[model samples]
Target: MVTPVHIRPKDDEIYLDCNATTPVLPQISRAVSHTMEQVFGNPSSSHITGLQARYILDNARRLGCEVIGAERGQLVFTSGATEGIQTAVLSALTAVRKQGQVTAGKYLLYGATEHKAVPQALAHWNELLGTKAELKAIPVDRNGLLDLDFIAQHLPHALMISTMAVNNETGVRQDLATLEKVIRQHAPGVPWMVDCVQMLGKGQLQLAQTSIDYAPFSGHKLYGPKGIGFLYVREHAAFTPLIIGGGQEQGFRSGTENLPGIAAMHTLFELLLDREQQVFKPVATLGAYREQLLAALRTAFPTLELNHAFEYSVPTTLNFSVRGVPSRDIMDVFDAANIRVSSGSACSSKVTRSYVLDAMGLDDWRSQSAIRLSFGPATEQATVDAACARIEEAAQALRHSCLLLSDTNEDFDSELDGVVQLRFDAQCCYLVIDRSAREMAVIDPIPQLADRIEKLVACQHYRVKAVVTTEPQGDDSTAAMLAQLLCASGCDAERDNVGWPLAAQADCSTPVDCDVPTDGCLLVGNRRLYRVGSRQPVYLLSSPIEPTAGARVDFAFVGEQAAPQVLESVLGEHTLVCRKWDDDFAIASQLRELKGEG
Candidate 1:
């Protein structure tokens, strides 16, 4: 085990998003710091200080080549995999330009499940070079394996093709040897670039023995520093420098050498290739760890389904979907327990579904609810045990089914019990269901989600008991529509002379007619709603209301000008505050536990 130079802080969170990026190792940090302090010099100068820096850079390059089984001249240091991709695409298109006129009907192809960077880089450089080559995506099977038949058909007219050794989301590995054979058989001279970023430390690579023209590796993915990576170029392949400056990397790339980052990567490469020390876990050990994690997940979620088959993917990642839960809910519960996971590539935010899973033809539910859990190469057994324990507790909390629904979720028809919060744009609505009686109430319904509410009520055969509006009603169309569907009653306080209603009001045309209590408290079934006095009136729900004054407030609906101090004084700290424009929504049970509730 690598020892820390200083005392480490208490680690309260479990980080399992290593596929997105790994935390820098202590040894790597030391190496970077050492280089910055002792060997700081410009490698381009011809002085003694410069020669010392040059020695360090050259040694790092040689070690990188050895780790990947490449030769001395094959590796060129880059900022990251993205930069390497840009360089490779530029070189390939430059070679095509060197040939006669650009041919019509030519295509540039990439794997359908590739990281967004590959196809994007291909399109960017293709347009800049005026190649006009049609870009196409090679389809993948449900296992996320590239379609070889598609490649064979398009190889004759291809300018270049890009593929990944390992997928980031699914952890699926491709049959690179078979792919290489087919490419050479169809078009021998065409340039092939493989995104080998995820393959480092997880699998072996022998670049010299293969016919691959370009391959890129990133340091951050394998526990080194970010903003540092390398690209491998075949000696006989056509080459052009993407960055042109004072002669560097033999004119292939141009920049002052990042000596500190290079030194950190050198330390990482040493650890990976060190057979004697064996710092990283062996294949068998990692396989055993994966089995333990899978068992824990199955125990937590009895209906768990793997997104990709185990035999085809790397052991470090597990992409899965539970039958009834959405990914946002899962992430919320996990975050409450201090466990970090992801839905898909961190590069794409606010995307509700995984395009990778969609391209593989998975069901809409699976694609919309997939969660990715990834482990670092050096994850310890103790950490695994702690993470498994947290997963179990989080799963138990999710079983209560207090779901947070928004426009982004797809399963709007599912009948869930307890309190379900629905969000539309800036408005919030609640569905309080009494499953035993088959009755539900719609609170603060918005016009945008009117159709969804109708479909849900119809599917579940729910009798709409009442439509209650807490604020002054502007557009009563939504209330009218729900009333027409269910013939439900409406409840609201009488409008005061000051233009602000003492409580909420429904239009007279709607079937709603209810007696507002003198204390501004409305009892709907077993729930009690107290209308707090404000500029824009707010309501508090104390469920299963205790006759005692200390009964806990379960939920609160606040308006635009409901002062924070007023809420803090009136409601308990455990109350789930719902605002008009609150960006994040939390599961009711999880939020309660986080607030120190039983």
Candidate 2:
């Protein structure tokens, strides 16, 4: 079992949610502090302190311009990338209107997989100005790559086009070069914006070489201070100011400049650029580290699914879904293990499904079950190894937790003749067979245990005749999946043969394949399983008969919502009461008791 990596500080959270927001590096802390303390004067003050702040701001702007490859173009500082994106998009739309492009209503085209901020910004401007510009969403394929054809076809009519350089959820990179080529070929001189928040430190962007009109970035993503971001607007691009006041930010964004944030970002950018060339090169070993972690996690959970294709996404982020496990459950497991990760975008974490994954055409199982693991330049091999070990341990514990009635206890096992009983989560699945005939049948098998059932069938070399179910009223997805697996495994039993009680006939969401009536017997191999009314059975009964009505019943399966009041009747008194899950603690306590408390 993997334990906590450290114990003293208690802040040993293995942060893997970098795409949301990265930590401010200690290297830049001093710069940020010095600027905040010494350069507190307003840049517009025109005094000694004010001039000093203004000089620092100008220097920061120059460095930002150099980093983004827009030496001649202007850089506007905002609270963060969201404001920058809003400013850029709104300015472009207004410029389009001034150019008389709204004859049929101005259009703003954006990717379906873009950050919510992009579309929301457009909406905000449209509503604020009452311009009533129409918004269009460009679709992406199952791999999360933008459909260039769709964009190219719509480029001519669109007043503005917006897309992200990299997806925050899956880390899927969009090819800006190809996008620029398409725009140049089809619709030249159009405003195009890229949300490069996720790519600030992770991707080496060459905006100066491309036809990108505007690109917004966040300093925090590059290990700089939060509440600081910049917008790069290509020279001679259409522009407007959303927050106009004292004609600050080249008569665009009007606010007291965030001098400290700008200075800190300036220093971090230079360090990050050098770090990009010298140290903390995550791109070099990220893929290999991911493989190592995956291999280790797979040892504990072989059914884990990597959600994104490697070729289409960056090496620093990995999205995975584990079958039969919910994303919330996975998050809880990781949280307990001191490994921090996210189920999806932090902005849309409240939503159960990941719209990004959904737009990529993943089914409900994959999209809702995903967890994102993002690495940073500072992440080391040792940390990755420890986190992977903890992940594997958690996965193993969770995978087998369904069978555990308590931490130390397992289901009671009973074997008689050719019959066996396997209980899990307070539920029971009985296997009955005729060894001579090589025919076997399972009663009330939980679908979550399909793998275990498949393994058992293969090991015993028994041909499954049918799967008899007692409670067919709950979510039938699990039952349906189990049926499909069993049928595909060469079992003669059909998925529709999932037995349902007549009392629950109306309550069952799935169609009842086999209606199990009271006093009715289903033949399996050479044995007969009699469905007695949920009543106490008589212990003294005849046995060793033929396979017909006269045949002796081997077992009585008590189903859900059974009644009380059973006098002795048909089958023998040896009754099997199926277990029911009360709750987590109850099951754990029962398991502990079954294993004998320490």
Candidate 3:
């Protein structure tokens, strides 16, 4: 008998999807709540309340720019990254037209692996708005890095080029300095916009030192409030205003600002500076955590394959796949075990496969099997340990399920009378019957064999009266799982019994809703099944002695060694029949032995 896994409930839910969105820090939450409660005045007003709001907005602008190494009065607040990207592309293209650079159709270039927002925004402005801008997406290598050679050839013909400072899906960071060098040398003053959404809060972006003309940052990705992000424009860079209304954000972006969200974002930047200093000081501590996690996963799943190299990506993020297992199945198991993870970016988790990996030259199968696990300051060692344990157990269950389905057409002969043994590698289950009584019993059936068992029982025309099982040693319990399936099929298999290794009782109860008594006597037609007591079979089907001292046994269907010497010493004279008589168990045993875990 195999025992079901028992998971301990934790005090708080474990979160590993930081790349999607982080939980707002306590300080940021407090500041946002306080501002929402106290400040509701329009920043453009002249009264004291409005002046205070104006001061808050100005302060946020100043500090936010400084954090990204931009000069004062250069940061423009927007709704979020999507709006910021649209504004940046629109402003750059409009400026190119005004500067007499669109004599031929203006061209916009971006990396092949950029977020969907960048390419789609450019397409919308190019085709729908009659901007006459042409768009080109550069290709990335197998490792998801940009192709610089193609950029060098195409840069001179483009009006603006956009690329992300860090990829959102793979956490692969691009060298902005090198890109800036390429643009300045080859394209010569072609405005560049860096989609730095994922880079914010993780590290400082020296935008002023680089040749990048524009950059975008988001608030929620930095653990601040959502619906507020900023765009950084270099001093004296060519640009046009996207919105034309009341002069807010220096006439670049119009409408009243989200004062609370802006202030909250400012506070987040300040706290982020301190957190990065503490969390990544001397060196990044996340690398050590990554090593621990990878080691644990490797120990649990020897065939785990990493999707991204460590040198090209941030340590806080990882993408990997367990060989031969579907990512959706893995995600489901993790979710059921209370571990939060993602099969792809939150934006495209529903797309079935990752376009990011597909662009990186991975085939559909590998892309479908990929899972992303990102870490944050809140992730602890204990959480990692528990999550890994759960993942390993889930993978093991899947492996067993797959193995059970293999060689389905193969048949085996049993050496026992009135018993048919179905062998799956080293494990064997028995079906017992009394032909005259027309009753049958299934012992320790696995879920993978549910259909086969049902078909066989139906073909035999034997009514399954009771289901029985022996104690399981570990997390491979098939008794409870099998009984539930059998019962659900409208078979009158109402009850199940467990034999030796009494600790299995608690470990075997989670997967089913049925009673597993420690000791019981079940009558299946004319055959009686009961636990073997000391020096005696507890009961016989047809006995006159009442079985108090000892029951005269007709025959026994021995699945495995009942106890140390219970079967051998008691039934020494009785003819012992081998429940399993096939080479399937031998093959399974050899496979396990070759793997060194037999």
Q: lDDT tens digits, residues 134-245, model 3?
A: 7888899888888998899888788789998888878888877787777788988888889998887566677877777778888877677789898888888866777879
Global lDDT of each candidate: 0.77, 0.69, 0.67
Query: Please, what is the TM-score per model?
Result: 0.70, 0.70, 0.64
Models, CA RMSD each: 14.0, 13.3, 17.4
Candidate 1 lDDT over 71-145, as tens digits, reads: 734799999999999999999999998887464579899999999999999989988888999999999999999
Tell me, by lDDT, which candidate is best. Answer: 1
Residues 1-598 of candidate 2: C-alpha lDDT, one tens digit per residue = 6567643323666777888877777767888898888778898888999999888888888877777777677789988998889889788877866876662565778999999999998888877766777888899998888899998888887778899899999999998888888978888887889999888767676677777888898888767778999988887888888798888887878988888888888886676657345446667587887778778767766778888898988888889887755677567667766777899999998998899988988876778788998877666788888888777777677565542222223222212235666544345566666666666666667655566676555544666655556554233554555554553243333333344222322222221112233443444454555544433311111233443334433344544443333312322334323333324575345435544572
Number of backbone collisions per candidate: 1, 5, 3
Which of the numbered candidates is closest to the native, going by highest TM-score?
Answer: 1
Question: How big is the positional error of residue 77 in model 3, measured in Å on the Cα after superposition?
Answer: 1.4
What lDDT would candidate 1 get against the real structure? 0.77
The 10 consecutive residues of candidate 2 with the worst lDDT sum are: 506-515
User: Can you tell me which runs of candidate 3 are displaced by over 4 Å?
Assistant: 1-11, 103-106, 275-283, 377-386, 389-598
